[model samples]
Target: MTTYLLKSGILLFIFYLIYRLWLENEKMFLFNRIYLLASLVFSLLIPLQLISFEPSATSKIISVQLDELAIQKNSQSFKSLAESLDLTNIILAIYVTVFLVLIIRFLLNLFSLYNKVLRSEVQFVKGEKIILINEPILPHSFWNAIFINKQEFKNDRIPSELIAHEKAHLDQKHTLDILFIEFLQIIFWFNPLVILYKRAIKLNHEFLADAVVNNQFREVTKYQSLLLEIASNKTNIILASNINYLITKKRFIMMTKKESPARIFLKVCSIGIITSLLLFVFSCKDNPEESNTKKQNKIEKSSVGIEEKSTLPDEDDTVRSLAGLEIKPEFPGGIEEFYKFVGKNYQAPEEEGLKGKVYITFIVEKDGSLSDFKVLRDIGYGTGEEAVRVLKLSPNWLPGTINNKPVRTLYSLPITIQSPD
Candidate 1:
């Protein structure tokens, strides 16, 4: 889970950097909107290994895997690891707590907007339903409904430009985009990049609405003045698209600036090239069959037994953690069979009453053999050595894989020994 989050965060940072450097200031409002949305979506999907390509022959070989697996232990009853309040459990508890709080806040905001809609008077103007609320807040739109001040509607003070802006937001379905980004924020609340993404998405939405109003009215100076007037009024609704969102110098400049077709085409081509490079760097993997054949050849050449000289390259023989593999290494008949095998073969040292666990870790090699035994923790009286002896006698395991190619994975086991008591 940590590895996935790290990859996702890094991808998001890079995509956002691209936007800030090239796309953010351009006059292509619609294209910029699409780019921002696609960046967020691709940032999520690329890390999941969804779009894979064949690794190039000239590319240097690299292995991507977890550095450490969550520590687990087995006892008489095989109790869950969650029973202990370790550091991982504490961190998970905090994360879930924050997630739930954000969810509740989001629901409350939606309900508040819904309750206002239910109580307010609805009037249809030019085939669009407008909700007239008795509040001093600026105008906003939520999914197909335009909200305006009730007094302004009664006194004929609401400007057509404001109504047109809100309608543009509704017609373009900007609220759905806001909701999607809001949900992503809820999931990744700890990530600062997600916060920046929310701001970018909302700003682009305002740009789209502003473009519509400018084109409709054709009076750029008048529209800019009206935007300055509306910017003074405050909005409390976070979920709705407000008319006065971020009326900054950039928004004003974007309204009048124009780009040539050639420059636009060139920028888009550059984005494509960058995206292709990212996909190749992060998603491509070596051919599984070719990797397996090479491993076999290495094993055949090794006169020293498989126990001493591994098939992996001397310089790049890094053992991956179990959590990183697509398919986890397992004993011949799964974990229960492993327990039985250990119980049958293990000779417990002659101690009066040993009532603790012996923790052992080993590397499961590509050839389904276990090596590099390590005793992390053990009871006294040769109990740890006895556990290693039993593991060495056990049968070969099913090797783990990354991108469907076999790789060396680290495995940890804890044996519970309770003498006759």
Candidate 2:
């Protein structure tokens, strides 16, 4: 478990670096405003690595032991380990699901891009004597003569000012930005932080474009009306662009924000600091602890004494000798005997996701016969039954003694079905 956490942390750092350099290309805000991006990145990466590792056989065994300790939960420390295992599994599932979704979305976007690039029917809006080259990208509105499918503009009259707004997407190359974010979305689909980043970049794209349009186009009120006019239509797809659409009211407010440039820069820096600290702390903490000494498992003593007794106990004599009364024998004399029986009798059943835990408990009669069994931890299907069959057939045990008398006892065994490490 400790090893897994450390590995996950390392993967996350690599992922972050990958994001900042290759993905962001210094154009995005991984370093700019850190709060959302940094935190989001953390959430995203942690889940992803947690899931991707997918608990090896040893890890699954460890998890089961932890879970048993949890079930029998007497120790707070052991219980915590068990809880952590559960948490890891949950995080793993979420990360995998998210990543899968992101991959699908990426493929969808890619297909869309490929389809568009290969498309025909170029329609350029003619301005009497001025001929224009219709860009397939931005300002994809009826006003700009760039409608993909034309149910969009039957009797609608569009204002010219809105055309400048979408043109900003083109002039500033926001389509590429959109594509970049779309690509990132596919890669880090499991990370909600990346999703947030996409949204932020997208919103920022609009804001930047809005600022450009407002700065360059001199017709503010007219453009606002144009925005309202074109706002009637929005693209059906999330990645698709509508000429006049607002993602959030906040984008509108940013357009009117009165904050000085200094304050904005300070805010960005503050966010950066917090995010850097979080990533650093998270990455650093996952490393193995420094210890002055290392510990190894103490020797595993066999259930049977080191020496073997060659003489077989006489059945009736054994019953009569101990406490003067007959008792059914319990578990095979020792752990070695128990497992040897299992090895000889064991059968692997066909079942997936059965590699967690298999706990069994049975009554050991004074004569060593196991009966009335139950699965303490059943892996699945025939696994628990297989485990039971092995235990039940293990001949006689040296019946447990109570005051020089033989007695039946309940013996509990929890066998974790871990893969060979």
Candidate 3:
């Protein structure tokens, strides 16, 4: 969720900066706005693909034990060692727990808010040739079908425009959007992307609602004046922005500033954004893959393996390679148990090697078999084969998969071989 939000935030920020520049009537710079849209779509619709782990809809308490870490066969052992080396994630874990609590609390708040809105009395009033809902705020009376403070309508300064505006909110199903955005924030609380999402949705709603009210009044001047007049007041139950907030000022200015917004600019932006979105959707995205050097070495080794396909490369017939069999782990313990499986069966190569390190890359197959092992960082012929030799005798490893279906994994083993004759 954190990573997704960050990705979304970066995209949104570009869009925002571009939009802001557009607002200022200046040159616009657009980056990959599609990333933001893709992120938004994925966050709301395809969260599973975007997220690293399945986020529990309901919160769960996490237990910590430095002594007993869960391990999966054939998984990397570095995680435990790294965590033990650094205590930062311990604090992050606590933060993550608190964040979950916040999500739960926010969800409950939404339910309460929804119920309150639903239960509010609805009444319509048509008097003095105007339409308004009398919401049961205080000093209530009839304006339209909704009841609100009668004195409010009676105020000599009361512009009928505000009523139409609020009514438009109810009529256009805007509250549902607010509810949706609130839920998103709850889920992606730590993500600054959520903040950007909130802002975007709010801005869109205001733009939409403003348009609705303007269409009804027909007198653009009166509506604009009304917004400016009320720009100093307090409004309760606002989703994010207060009625009299800074954004409100921009909104009011846009409402008043009669100008033909550059259709060309909006068009160009739309084109650029759509193009970027396409790239984001189809690109070979960064989920998890080997580093460039390792990938290159793996490719080279694969080519070598193809050429040497007929030979076993060593005389150790008693040590048959387990590299080609896929072994299922009893439990998926992530990465620690993976290395434990390696450690359990692998004999550390003799220290009296030629050079600094012998790095071999190998594939752990679906049947818990290891095969196609190749030297990535080679010390020499002896150490290179030694790396493969030790790996060949490795215990049947835990099979890995992408979506619960078994898949072959390429792993690199780097060993420091000391120089001694």
Candidate 4:
């Protein structure tokens, strides 16, 4: 979800920039609207395809123990807190809480609009519903209804241009675009870009309506003049598209902007760039098959009775962790018995005044013998040395395997030492 939001935001940002820089003032209002909407949908979908061209396996297996730590500290105080607080659950709880809240808010807005419709007098004008309400508000449109003040309608005070604009909005079904972006906002409420996306789409709806009205009348100045008159009158209904001045200036500017066929190339280039970036961002996965193959070869060599072994380039070479293992190593008895062994043998470096945990790692050899014990972290006072000493004295494990053959795997543990009273 995080990756999807991130890629979506980046794409939206870039596409929005393209609109502002090259297409906003062009005579391609319909193209611009479709471009914005399509860009948003594509951004969301692009991240879901995990299409990486990279191979999964390698031949030379190198240990990656230090990349991700797997500490096994058993200090009851710290252990209880860590186990009780699951990060994934906490994040999920927060996301669901916010999502539910947004859903409730959206439902409330819809109900508010519906209640307004119920209270208003509906007049069927030329096969379309023209809803006249008692409130002193500018004309707006929602769904298939054109909302206007009852007094304005009765008094003939409503301008024909305003009715035409709202009617154009209704005819185009602009409400669907608004509702789509609204639902998207609810899902990605955490991302600020969703808010911007909602605003951009709403503004585009107005642009499309203005274009339609002007085209019908063939009078851009008169249509913009009508916009100026209704700029002061605003409506609080969230779901309705109210004719207001908040975006009227931009609408006025866009009405006068000339066509730019030449700059269409720039818009095309911007889209291409965004697509390429999204592809690179989403197509990534780790290749593990290489490491798996090397372990299998070594296991095969051992089964054939080959005593001589190939030397690693360094001590860190060939170590595989529990994550890399097809079958994890186990103590002769199970995890509980392994803990009991640690409790019996791991003495705290109390006399030396050790006061913190020491992380120790060792390789479980193909034969199940623990070897190459190393200290990953330590405090002073022989704490790390003490942990390593106890680990060296521990018995062999039931080796981890790949494809039913025992393979060398790395195991990590943390031992904490406390000060003596």
Which is the leading candidate under TM-score?
1
Give me the displacement of residue 71 in model 2, in angstroms.
14
Model 3 per-residue lDDT tens digits across residues 1-421: 3333444455555555554544332212122233333446643443223323322222111111112222222223434445654776786787789778977777675564455446654334453223222442321112123234444655634556665665555565555666666776665676676676566555655565566778787887777776666655554444422233344556765565554448545756675675466345433222222232334443466445544332212211101111111232322365555445544443333434333544455666777687887675554556567556766766676665544656655554545433322
lDDT of 3 at 234: 53
Q: Model 3 residue 190 lDDT?
A: 63
Name the lDDT value of residue 294 in candidate 2: 11
Give, for candidate 4, the lowest lDDT window spanning 10 residues. Answer: 311-320
Worst 10 residues of 3 by lDDT: 315-324
Q: Pick the candidate with the highest lDDT.
A: 1
Full-model lDDT for every candidate: 0.74, 0.46, 0.47, 0.67
lDDT by residue (90-155, candidate 2, tens digit) is 988987787788778767865764455446344444431111223322245221233443222222
Q: What residue runs in model 1 are displaced by over 4 Å at the alpha carbon?
A: 54-85, 286-325, 331-387, 393-421
User: What TM-score against the true fold does each predicted structure earn?
Assistant: 0.74, 0.44, 0.60, 0.68
The local distance difference test score of model 2 is 0.46
Task: Provide the RMSD of all predictions against the true structure, rounded to 1 decimal.
Answer: 7.4, 18.3, 11.5, 9.0
